[model samples]
Target: MTVIKNAELTAGNSFTQNQALGLLTELVPVSLNNINGREIQTTSAKKLHAYLGVGRDFSNWIKGRIEEYGFIYEQDYINFDSPNLANQSTESVQIKQWKTKRGGDRRSKDYCISLGMAKELAMVERNEQGRAVRRYFIQCEERLQHIAPQDVRKLRDQLKARITAANDFKPMCAALELARAEQGKLTQAHHYTSESNMIARLVLGGLTAKRWATGNGISGDPRNSMSADQLKHLSYLEQSNITLIELGWDYHQRKTELTRLSQRHLAKQLEVAND
Candidate 1:
């Protein structure tokens, strides 16, 4: 593209596997019962620590954190009869030694540090925990001296290769992109002498405001960095095909008409979309 002025706000941090899984579950609650948000499989709970970008034993680290929250007490498989024994057996515990639950989806695998971190991960629906085997991406550099780096390096290489491969955005913007694609008929990409271009010489068309209250992400999408009303106004500008001229709209307008199109509107008409 022609460098559309940063086009988007700064991209946030990369997700770890657990974070991705959590986000995926949060984003697609129905999918949690399935796999990859589709009719894959329910038996296999996804491993998310790798998608979250953390060191090896991160699950243990997270579980450790969850344990630290004070509510989650690791009741040793102790013999209540022999209370002196610090460790207990699985057979004796019903609630697994009486632990106060801290932060965790029903399943420990899906749990992450924040409930509002990302869409699929933070969604409330996927917050269920079922006992299952989970996987994590272990970093090679974090390996202890005595451990082998064979699998760690392999995972690192695979993840590096997947960084670009996995960028395939989900269906979130698919509908909008389809709508925009349909608009392409009206918006001829290039027209040397077309009247659409002819009109461009005179009219400034439309605009929302000078400063954008919420400058990033979808309106009403909690994952978005900006507020719904702000995105809604920008959507209006995008719809009107005019420069929205946001608060810090690139520190330049390139032309006076582009500048003059700026106008403020009440932050109303906000609507929540499918999470």
Candidate 2:
């Protein structure tokens, strides 16, 4: 992608993983092809030290830089607790970890740097690598600027999906209202609301819809806060509840049946996630 003109430097500090790798390769000849994802850049501390030309005292220097720049661990850089040993030959693993050291038993796997941390390092370290990093970041920022329109479109599509999910919940609410009207009881109305809360908790990972929305930094009805997959799960439960009510099941029977099924389904999902 061609770089856009007049892009802001500050905007370069939030690159996706692909963008970071592209820029890194442009600056240096090293290949960091082992990592996966859109938000992480993993390389050895030794590699970073060599590139920065900071000599053999890189451990202390990096520690000092992190403190001086107020870098947040995991956000700016992740010092992995366990070394990544997946798919490595025995000799290569030994060679890779030969000069790497850590404070405790944890071997140095790699330093996972975010775009923000990389930008700070480029600015703080005055050397050839620093200049190259600065130029690469500028180009990356310019390319991101060119994709602004696509980002806006993606956001709009997401908002539309959220709205559709919110609308889907209205039928369930209406069906419960009808059940209350047929029984002509205030208790039935309250029971349906309680049951809805239970279902929300089951499918939405333990929070009531409103609480989930607030916790996720969203506003408005929590039902609208669900992803498409979550909406599908909730819709299935709601439709089952509506079907049971239509077949003349009382509130107590519907509650007992739905509660048992929801709990079992949630358990299965949890089991799969753990595996």
Candidate 3:
């Protein structure tokens, strides 16, 4: 049995590119609303409640999850008054009620969470409906971004850019440095580094960063001396390892999964690259 070091599975957002594609297949077009003067896509708590088939008292459930997960109020969700309310006094007041259905009850204030937060909430919800809702959120993201998976290079570049923009290269460098810190650590704890090299060989024309840099006569920190293409492949490996770690995969399990994913990605890239 593989022993997961940090098995707090609740930490990961649990979203993936393949799952995002699956979500895109099930999407229904809806007009996205604006938030704070920016056009944004969001799903209401009421809609999610109905979709999830949770009981009518979903407000309590939503509140529970929001508080439990420490989801930021303005960032993850927002409460606002309904403009369609009949009472002028009520209209002026910030009411946060949602109708259970289209014409159901407007008993309380309505809460709206971003699609991303919805996916995270769904991961913890652990029900079939919750899974479906998570897919919907991924679909929302795909549609919003206009993702085209057929273009492998384009997609890889986009993911690489997004990961790079969101995270400092320090994490990637740190992971590499940690891998080289000790041979035992590399072979045992950081086995994913080996799989990463395997993936890099296929995608980068049979060359890992260190090997490539050495062959080209570059000295010191092959990671720092990587070409753009080599860096992108390294980024993908780093992301794979990070995702596995976040999902609470044990060291060995992560290595196995990383190997499989890297091989799969390499195959896909080959198909597209050859086309």
Q: Give the alpha carbon lDDT tens digit for every residue of 182-275 in model 1.
A: 6562423342122222222322222111112133222322112222333333343333332222222221332332324324333223223422
Task: For candidate 1, give the lDDT of residue 237.
Answer: 33
lDDT, candidate 2, 84-154, per-residue tens = 33323233334444332331223444565655566677677765456556566555555554757565354
Error of 3 at 119 (Å): 1.1
Scored by Cα lDDT, where does model 3 land? 0.56
- TM-score to true structure, per model: 0.20, 0.36, 0.36
Q: Which candidate wins on lDDT? A: 2
lDDT score for residue 116 of model 1: 17
Candidate 1 residue spans exceeding 4 A from truth: 1-223, 242-261, 264-275
Itemize residue pairs with steric clashes in candidate 2. 17-38
In model 2, the worst 10-residue window by lDDT is: 1-10
Q: Which lDDT value does model 1 have at 100?
A: 23
